[model samples]
Target: MKNCIIIGVAGGSGSGKTTVAKNLVKAFKSEDAVLVAQDAYYKELKEMSVQERAGVNFDHPNSIEFELLKKDLETLLKNQIIERPIYDFKTHSRKEETITIHPSKIIIVEGILLFAVPEIRDIFDVKIFVDTDADEMLLRRIERDIHERGRTFESVRDQYLKTVKPMYLEFCEPSKRYADIIIPRGGENKIAVNMVIAKLKRYLQKGAL
Candidate 1:
């Protein structure tokens, strides 16, 4: 099997990192690329009450099961299939089901805190940081959490003020310095996204992976 290319997409919540990741997958075709979300590896909170889990600072690096994520990524890089976990944001816990992920030519790992951890940062062949204004991100986040994550507007706003913004400022923003590419305006910046795609295609052509 040919070597796989691992791309890390990091940004604050609602920064459109997912858009960049999706565009990359679309660029390569889903058959050639697989997307892995770090949110799925949120440390299982089975031990905590729902209320307690809700209060947990998910934006922190300590909240992610990086060891498991590292193991799965290593397995994928070795051209092996692995069972990826599914996390339920509404319940703030893991689901029993897992999705099987096969090795692909490209793997896009997208997360808010991927770069906050050194071990996770070292595994990426390309590191991308999606930058967006905090106000814009907060708006997007509020909408997403309320509509999709079953969160109320008040709760989302409270969480943002209590933990999200603080964590982003402390961890996510600082991690931007490590990015090989910084995408402003998130995934909507077609020029930046295309540039990344072109670079990856060239690397594949050169068998760099």
Candidate 2:
């Protein structure tokens, strides 16, 4: 992992941050890059009841286990292996099992509030923010929650209104000022994605020098 590059992809939930991260990973190939999702680092709620956990404000920065994430990233940067946590969205807690993630030349960190914290933001060589319209993001969130996260439409809408939108405005949106690049229209912007890939290639090549 000599000259390993860490890229941070930050955006509102359903704003296509994951899509951008996935595209970058595909471009780099699995052997050369690793994707670490911030969502996986959500704080375990073992002490809370299911009802209480359901009411928790997941969008807040305090809800993530960022210390663990930072340690894992540091380990990866040192060319070592780390065990990443497994999160269960349905249960609102972590699973006992962990996934073994090996160090790679490129590490893509994808999360909604990554750039909001200075400790996390400072580690990234490239910080990207995906900018999609708020209305569109809400629609995508509703769809994803219903189909993938086992959430009911009413619940999704309620959570979005109660926590998600406010948290995004207070934390996620303000972090955009820290971004090195902002991609509009999220994953649909192929040009922006390609540019990012090219920039990464340049960094890799320069490191070789």
Candidate 2 regions off by >4 Å? none
For model 1, the stretches where C-alpha displacement exceeds 4 angstroms are none
Q: Largest lDDT belongs to which candidate?
A: 2
lDDT of 1 by residue, 123-207 (tens): 9988999999999999999989999998999999999999999999999999999999999989889999999889888877787
What residue pairs are clashing in model 2? none
Candidate 2 local lDDT, residue 117: 96
Q: What is the number of residue pairs that collide in model 1?
A: 0
Q: What are the lDDT figures for the candidates, one per model?
A: 0.93, 0.94
Per-residue lDDT of candidate 2, residues 92-188 (tens digit): 9999999999999899999999999999999998899999999999999999999998999999999999999999999999999999999998999
At residue 141, what lDDT does model 2 achieve?
97
